[model samples]
Target: MRLMRIGEPGHERPVLASPEGRHHDLSSVTADIDGAFLAALADDPGLVPEPERLPETDIAGHRIGPPVARPSALLCIGQNYAAHAAESGAAPPEQPILFYKSPNTIVGPYDDVLIPRGSKKTDWEVELAVVIGRRASYLDSPADAAAHIAGYAVSNDVSERAFQLEESGGQWSKGKSCATFNPLGPVLVTADEAGDPQGMRLRSYVNGEPRQDSGTADMIFGVAHLVHHLSQYLVLEPGDIINTGTPQGVALSGRFPYLGDGDVMELEISGLGGQRSVCRPA
Candidate 1:
């Protein structure tokens, strides 16, 4: 089922879209889409109520907030796509290139992405975001890692190239954590509904023009391996988010120019919903 949260920020209510297009309330089921609730939903499939009648909501009309309001951590991988790695003039890493983005950077779906003040190389990365469902540590294998996932969502890993590559002494996080950088969700699709995460077609468009377009097959490290690899270093807790890297075709790739104010970004993974945001001056 396509699960969503509605209402105002700091007051979102859980909801589900029924097969008949009715809005069945899951608010009666849970408070937020965090780790604990995810684990519970995983165990008790019946907890989510089927809405007899879809309720009217203004998700886009209301102030849409970040899908996961309070994620425990927001981890990201870099250069996980060989083409994207090559585009950025880097080699595929011997291991996953892991980094963290401050949770404060989280923003609502379709919100305007701010190009940081004094920035010139603002870039966009359309990526698949993994939301953790249960606590996991010392994963024995990639297959075991797959079971820990709660759902998937679309995300834009917005970057300030200058801060990410030059000003901050080469630390990618420096350019990655700008406020409103991680725009996530139109909806968080549960794992059962998001089949075969590895083969989906993912794309990014700026101002209605396509920029990055590729398949998840292009990923150097697939989801299971990434989860297994990451669990070796840190425990994967519920509500933690890991943004798998973007495919090639970013402005940094030179196929397209960098994003400027008023440029719009739209991204999608085949089964997951699409997300769109406009660029604006910081």
Candidate 2:
């Protein structure tokens, strides 16, 4: 199922997309798409009313918000793609390297990306974001990670290279936690609907010019392994989002210019939908 939230920012209503590509209001079933709703849907998808007889919403007329309500935690993995590691002048690590984005950074997919004050190295990263469905802690194996995931969504891990590299005191989150940094979804597809999480094609374009083009297959640490590894040290709760990192091709590599006012970014993942953001001065 492709679930979404539509309306103006902070006032979105939950919705479900039908097989025929129509949308139905899910407000009658749930107030918002969040941990509780995900847990309930796991038990009975029928908990969401059928769209056939319901009044269809004009999706194009409304703004699409992040598929889920504010997640409890916005976690990220760094250098999970070997090419990205190489571009950043690092070798692929044996284990997943983790980071955090303040939950406030979450924003709707099509929203404007703010270029923070005095910034000159804003960058783009197209990544596959994992949405957790069940609480998991200290899992025994990679196989168990599947049951804990609710679905996948396209994510742009927007970054500020200067703040991240030179001024961060070596902490990457310094550049990653700016407001509007993480543009999450146009839709959150169910795990059953998302197919193989590690095989999707991901791409990013700036002002209609290609920037990043790669596949999840390039990931050094796949989704299941990251989840399993993370569970060993931290509790993965329902509604927590994990950005699994990006493949190379960002401004930080010095191949493309950093984003500036009015520059637009477009990101997409094969089955997870896409995102577009226009840069604006903070």
Candidate 3:
């Protein structure tokens, strides 16, 4: 099932998009699509209620907010794609390289992406975003990781190279945590319906020109491994999102130009849908 939140910014209401492309109101079943709601649904699927029984909501004139609410943590795997690692001039790591972007960086998929002031090397990354459904502290094996995943969504892991590399003091969050840096969702496809996370074709474009174009199969550390590995070091709270890293063809490779005001960013993942964001001055 595809879950969505519709309305303006903070006023978004939960919605379930039917196979026929209809939006059914989910507010009566729950208040919002936040961590608590996701955890409850994970424990009791019936808590979502039946969309056929709920009122049909018209989302045409409204904005579609991020499928999941602001999460407790926004974790990311860096250079998980071998080609991307090569482009960044690094050897494929023996283990998953992890980092954190402030959770508040999340914005509606269609929202305006701010080009942080004094930023000149802003870039975009198209990644498969994994959403957690349960608290995972330490999983017994990578196979156990599937049970903890709530779903998947498309995420644009926006970055500023200058802040991330040059002025980071060896830490990346300062550049990664800029407001509106993470443009997430158009919809969140449940894990059951999302199929295998490692096969989806994810791509990105800037101002209508192709940029990143690769599939999740290129990821050095797949979703299950990343989750299992991370659980040993940090708790994966319900509603937490893990950006599985982007493939080759980002501006960071010096093959394309950095984003600028008035630029349009289009990102998509197979089955999960797409996001189109407009860039503007912060």
lDDT of 1 by residue, 1-282 (tens): 777777666687776765555555666567777777888876787767656543444444665556665888999999999989998999988889999998888887878899899988999998999998878799999989777888888988999888988887757788999989999887788888888889789998988998888998888999999999999999888888999999889989777888898988998889887888989888
Candidate 2 stretches with Cα past 4 Å from truth are none
lDDT of 3 by residue, 1-282 (tens): 799998888888999998899889988888888888888888987777666898998899799899999799999999999999999999999989999999999999999999999999999999999999989998999999998999999999999999999999999998899999999999999999999998999988899999888999888999999999999999999999999999999999988889999999999999999999999999
Q: Relative to the unseen true structure, what is the C-alpha lDDT of residue 157 in candidate 3, on a scale of 0 to 100? A: 95
Candidate 2 residue-wise lDDT, 95-132, digit = tens: 89999999889899999999999999999999999999
Which candidate number would show the highest TM-score if scored against the true structure? 3
Per-candidate TM equals 0.94, 0.97, 0.99
Whole-model alpha-carbon lDDT for candidate 2:
0.92
